[model samples]
Target: MKMDAFAFGITNWAEIDRTEHQGETGMAYWRTRYFGNYPNQIRVRWVEYTPGYRADHWCHKGHVLFCMEGELETTLDDGRKFVLTSGMSYQVGDNAEAHQSYSRSGAKLFIVD
Candidate 1:
């Protein structure tokens, strides 16, 4: 299906149940469209973290994180830490460090690659 600019639909994360990954924390809002009957190389997902939640240490092929709400802290394997709040965004991967995220008041992030 072809979509024009601004022709996509809005997907609400709260309406869907969170999928549990064995070692990951937070709920995820996910959506994707295939290209030419095959999976697309890029994916966009919104991840919501509850208070006192943290994710397992992992590395991505390439990713960008956009903080949509609340606060989140990420600690890298090298002990470097970054704190992000609403309206902030960062890119990682292709030499991206391994890291984990933690939130106290909860947070929502849009991740894309």
Candidate 2:
């Protein structure tokens, strides 16, 4: 069967409640299993955060972050900082360093793994 046959859906993040964490604020996540099976997975998520909000220092197993709207300021464990805006994307390998993200005027992101 075609992937799209079993993997089709839409989500509105603005209607979901925000998840809060220490050092992180005004954040929210909406996850969906779109395609593939367990072990071999395909998932999509929408992440957002408001101004002055920050994420804890952590790394992903292996994933890519695609900016959908607004701006994001990311700081890696190695002290490297990146300023990302809409239409921007980046990768975080298994060996990726821990990092924190903050926003000045709120931001939205799409995470695919």
Candidate 3:
């Protein structure tokens, strides 16, 4: 989706499409749904991971993530780990460094990229 710089918008989670993630393995399945083509090419989405879920690839891009429901852990290639619970937030740059995530139980997050 594309956005017009001058436009304004409003939305509710129920109104957006929930798209299944493509590609990946492990019991690590997940789903993401977002609305709006925000300015500066920003994308906002709601992501949920199943119990014992782990991401397929290490992400190198920057993101602003907020934990909305459940627990999730993010581990950097350098072995740094961070655990986030509800109401917690994390922000990182698009440093070419690698990072991956997992959840022992399950997790729901609001993410901006």
Number of the predicted model whose TM-score against the real structure is largest = 3
Q: On a 0 to 100 scale, what is the lDDT of residue 47 in model 1?
A: 75
Q: Indicate the TM-score of model 3.
A: 0.79
Model 1: per-residue Cα lDDT over 1-113, one tens digit each: 22223444556656645554433655433433222222334455777777777776556456688999999898877989999999998888755687777887888888876
Worst 10 residues of 2 by lDDT: 1-10
lDDT per model vs. reference: 0.68, 0.70, 0.74
In angstroms, how far off is 38's CA in candidate 2?
1.6
Which of the two, 1 or 3, has more lDDT? 3
Compute each candidate's TM-score over C-alphas. 0.69, 0.71, 0.79
Clashes of each: 1, 0, 0
Highest lDDT scorer: 3
**Model 3 lDDT, full chain set:** 0.74
Question: What are the per-residue Cα lDDT tens digits for candidate 2 across 1-113?
Answer: 11233555566756555554455465544444345675565666677676766775565455688988999887787889999999998777666677678888878888877
lDDT of 2 at 76: 82
Question: Which 10-residue window of candidate 1 scores lowest in summed lDDT?
Answer: 31-40
RMSD in angstroms, candidate 3? Answer: 3.8
